[model samples]
Target chain A: MSSIVSRNLKIYFRDKSAVFFSLLGILITVGLYFLFLGDTYTDGLADFNHPEIFMAGWIMSGLLSITSVTTTMGAFGTMVQDKEKKIYKDFYCSPIKRSVLTMGYIISSAVVGLIMTAVVLVITVVYLAANEAIVISAMLVVKMILLSALTSLSNTAMALFIVSLINSEKAFSAISGVMSALIGFLTGIYIPVGNLDEGVQMVVKCFPTSHSAVLFRQILMENSLNEGVKSYPAAAQAEALAEVKDVLGVVFKFGETECSAEMSLLILVGALVVFSSLSIFTLNRKKTA
Target chain B: MNKIVQVTSLKKSYKDVHAVKGLDFYVEEGKLFAFLGPNGAGKSTTIDMICTYLRPDSGKILLDGSEVGKNDDEIRRKIGIVFQDSVLDPILTVRENVTIRGSMYGLHGKELKEAVENACEVVGMTDFMKRPYGKLSGGQRRRVDIARALVNTPKILFLDEPTTGLDPQTRVNVWNTISDLQKQNNMTIFLTTHYMEEASDADYVVVIDDGKIAAKGTPAQLKEKYAGNYLYIVPKNKDSLLNTLKKNKITYKQNIDTISIPIVHTVDSLEILDKVRENIDSFEVIKGTMDDAFIGITGKEIRR
Candidate 1:
């Protein structure tokens, strides 16, 4: 595992264009956020108005979605390139377990996503600090990183699945673009779920991206556990949301909540396992085909 | 000698096209076996199956007596493959690529380092160890690829058109490296090449045409079997010589260039030699080559 990780890190660091594009993505997200909402903050933490919250949520959600799409694109694109060059054949023929290949790519892509997410976090924190809206906490930083990594894994898995079904880069690109757009729009990245009809909001909630956006927004907005819980009507909805918030808050240093962080951690970890298994199954199909 | 690899009735199809049609062959241990075939004759398909990259549609493969399908991981551990296409990671340095491949075989730390160094040395790539693989010349990259495969010290190595696009000089260099590795390690090698010269160096050669075995034997044996001894030629302009041979009732096959007679004894009779010299503008005898044998057996020239 360490060998695979080290090798992936080496490949990731070697490509200057990949690094530049990733940084550019983070910069654009941050720059857009500040351009729209930087001047809105007033006096301390009380300045959390609807538009300020909306912009903050938008920046977080948009950045996360872009990071997810870009990381998936880069990871699967590299895989396709490797396939074309027959590099995957060399690696596949080696004694390394297929699980190692899957994990190595996922972990490397997650790292990139984490890095991009960090850039956004730093930019947002700095802007917020400059505006004197709120003080940035180390706990929030940790939550953002963990959530970003999870989202990256999910995205990478989806990309791997897409790559398995097609053999051409043009087709992969077209599909990836369409899928990313749909995922982004459906997850309420461009338009807030609050602005959309309840039916549309219900449709959005069916996707993992919608859940990820909500989770990310909660983490970035510094929303309290009680405040988050009260927004849910049903007991189960409140319980699930409270549980997730507790896990996010505990990992990052947010206020205490009614649920254990272990449960939320399990959910994220479970999602990783499920998605990774799906990716591996897809990889097997490709190899056997 | 023990059979190192056995493939029985292997079949692979890509949709409607049958790539390999019920192919069967076995390679003995420590022998350099050459699979000679034209393009799309299932050479790569066979190699891919043996390396466990492509699963066969039917039949079975046994490597060193263990079923390949049942134990793909073990099979993979014992075999090293150099693909027809370049497989080197362009983003990695030469040394890094070797080390990573070695590590996959459970080598690491000093062992991995030493293996990488030795493989580089063997391929004459020591000087370019630090160079990124993408930056190297094509020949250099191929050498690195060879080193990467060798780093694991596999029991069997598969070379799929190893010198397909290389220049003459680089091809020779690559062959030399492979030869040295074979001699020093006593590794069983399965090589697929279109080049007759490459096939000539192998201990055994299997000529495949249209996904079936055209012939299989050592170079000398194949030449002897398909190419008859002593091709006698009568020049076109030597009408008297041809008439003399005809009057003598000498049996021969006539083509545009000359009339050929397959004979057991040498053309050393003075009377026959003098008649030929007196009437013929020119005449010559030449031994046949493997290329001729391939043409004789397959009834078609091996296309480039």
Candidate 2:
């Protein structure tokens, strides 16, 4: 399994195109936020003096959350090619067990996710600092880094489970096509959950990935959110803050019940465990092919 | 039987199609064994079971005295396989490919380097170890695959039509490499090939048709049973040869130029050769080949 893991890592890094293409979704999301929809989203939130920073945190957090997923999906691109070319048959007929091959793919993809997400985090931090938007707190940086690792694991597992169901490059290419185009919107980066209909809002809230968006918004926009509200009188600012939190999924709601940031983190972790178990179980049965 | 591999009552089927039907065969240690059959003869399916890649429906397979499917790792460590298809990562260099495979068997550092060198030496692949796999010719890539399999010094080597797609010259190179490996290491070689001439290199041969073993024997033994030896004589004078044939009571078929006699053994052919010696202008003895034996038993050629 270690050999398989090392080989996958080497293969992924050697293919320059794979590395660049894996981050394409994140790049597209950034492009859309700045050039395509920035003014529209910022113009509506005229109440906040620096709404751009808040939205940047939202988009960057969403990108970090989904990076592990799309990059891992790129990592599994190697496996899909191996299957298509029947190179996997050699490994199958070798002494190595099939479970090893499955595990190797999952672990290496997680590693790929971690590396890509870290690079993106560095870029996000620099961008936030240049704009004088981030709180620049030690605790906030530490929290963001820890959350990046957790989301990387969750996204890798989720990506692997989906990869297990597919056998062809053509099918996976179609999926990646859809993901690059729609993943940002799905994660609430393009359209905030509050602005969408109740049904669409529920999807963004219940979706395991959107949890990362909420956690990020709380940390990255903490200073700006507070400063933006301080200009107004205390009572009106308090009501408005409460309203935005509910609308933007900063605090999740189910009927009268409210979920804290900790609850959302638990959900992401739960998704990681479930998707990983399902991927390993299903792959072990069919990996010999 | 000093067997390296043994299978009894083995059966495998996919849905309604019975791929292998209660097959039985054993490969002796330190000898090349050929599994011969036409296309769809279940040759690969049988290899798959013996290699423990597929589970048999009802049967037993033992490799080097250990049960195959039950102790898969044991069976795996004792054997190395160069598959019929290309299995190398095209983008990686040959050394990288070999090193990764060696790691799987838990060899590293000095041991890995020596094993890699030895394997490449055996297949004459050391010169091209640094080249990208995809850049090499088909024959060179095959040799690299052979090196990968040999790096572990497996006790048994399985070659599933290793030379199927090579040109005539490269095919001979591959066969020579295989023969040299057997001579140096005494490894048991289990091979499947459509080239009937290659079977003559095997110490034993088994013919399968429709998932059943049709015949099994030493190459010489199969020739004796199915493909008869013959003597052909072209006499300068037909009258003299005819008189000798009549007196000897030889059952012979005479074409315009040659008289052919089906003989069972060398002694029989030599006796007839003595009688026709004075009258014959040119005489030749014909020994049966594996191709003849194959056609005699299965009534079809070994190609699709």
Best by DockQ: 1
Question: How much of the true A–B contact set does each candidate keep?
Answer: 0.88, 0.53
Q: Please give the distance, in angstroms, between residue B190's alpha carbon in candidate 2 and its true position after superposition.
A: 1.3
Q: lDDT of candidate 2?
A: 0.84
The digit string of per-residue lDDT tens for model 1 on B18-136 reads 88898889999988999998888899998999888888999899999778778888988888888888877788888888887888889889988999999889889999988889999
Residues B1-304, candidate 2, lDDT per residue (tens digit)? 5999999999999999999999988999999999988988999999988887888999999999999778888888888888888887877889989988887787889999999998898999889999988899989999999999898889999998989989999999999999888887888899998888888888999989899999999888898888878888889899888888988888988887898888888568777787778888998888887778888889997572
lDDT score, residue B185, model 1?
81
What lDDT tens digits, residue by residue, belong to model 2 across residues A213-241? 78877777776677666656877998877
- lDDT score, candidate 2, position B286: 88
Model 1 alpha-carbon miss at residue A86, Å: 3.6
TM-score of each: 0.80, 0.89
Model 2 spans with C-alpha error above 4 angstroms: A81-89, A92-97, A229-235, A242-258, A284-289, B228-285
Q: What's the lDDT for residue A189 in model 1?
A: 57
Number of the top-ranking candidate, with TM-score as the measure:
2
- Among all windows of 10 consecutive residues in model 2 chain A, the one with the lowest summed lDDT is A223-232
